[model samples]
Target: MKPEIFIQENIITIGQLLKKIGLIQTGGGAKFYLEKNKVLINNKKPEGRNSKVKNGDLLTINSNIYIVKKEQDI
Candidate 1:
């Protein structure tokens, strides 16, 4: 159930990204999901909500995982 949307950045805030992309049902949903230890970075377990996601990294939530390729040019 991985998502196709990619996050591009040298260090992306998980909470901000989640809200920006409408992944969680709500803003609080992101914190709740993260506190439940349901989020992983680069296939490794992540516990910090403010964790930064860099390029070529991987992120997983629930059954969905996303790989951070090149940063999206804004």
Candidate 2:
């Protein structure tokens, strides 16, 4: 099953999401990682670290899948 990540806010940044899921050690790493790897949000490439990620959005990074959901949905 794909891992689920709960968002307390209506939206979260791609960088923040990466840290929350332990993909990157720090927010600063998101930029380098995004540039070096394949990260898809809803099947499309993200603009950058600031790209918005909302509830129910699907994220595929380096062949791994993660689902974003509201905290209350759990």
Candidate 3:
């Protein structure tokens, strides 16, 4: 399923993504997930907590799939 949030910019941080997904209990929880390489951006593991995420990005966490794309008009 798709997330209710939208990615307007070409890039976003890993922490921001996790928080949006409701995976992280608090803002700091992102650090634990990232530190353990539990966060993957576009399949591969993220380089760091501040990794950039762009359009067409696919995020998989705890078996949950999140697609980031521009909101196109129907």
Candidate 4:
């Protein structure tokens, strides 16, 4: 099964999600990271740092896959 990331908010920006998952050291790094790395949301590239990621979304960073789930669901 893919790794799961539990979030309390209804939606989170891709930047925040990257930080929450420890993919980036800080939120500011998201911009540069996104430019250098391949990040896919539900099989497509994200719009940018501000792109929205919500419950049940699939996040792909490099070769890793993560599933977004609400905190209450766990």
- Each candidate: what lDDT? 0.70, 0.92, 0.72, 0.92
The predicted structure with the larger TM-score, 1 or 2, is 2
Better of 3 and 4 by TM-score: 4
- Prediction 4 TM-score vs. true: 0.91
TM-score of each predicted structure versus truth: 0.67, 0.88, 0.68, 0.91
What is every candidate's alpha-carbon RMSD to the true fold?
3.1, 1.8, 3.2, 1.6
- lDDT score of residue 71 within candidate 3: 60
Residue 43 miss distance in model 3 (angstroms): 1.2
Candidate 3: which stretches are off by over 4 Å?
Answer: 1-5, 71-74
Give the count of colliding residue pairs in each prediction.
1, 0, 0, 0
Tens digit of per-residue lDDT, candidate 4, span 1-74: 99999888999999998898888988899999999998999999998899999999998998988899989954
Return the TM-score for candidate 2, rounded to 2 decimals. 0.88
Lowest lDDT block of 10, candidate 4 = 65-74
Clashes of 2: 0
Return the clash pairs for model 1, or none: 8-71
Q: Write the per-residue lDDT of candidate 3 for residues 1-74, one digit (tens) a residue.
A: 57634665667787876776576867787778887655567789877667877778887676666777756556
Worst ten in a row by lDDT for model 1:
1-10
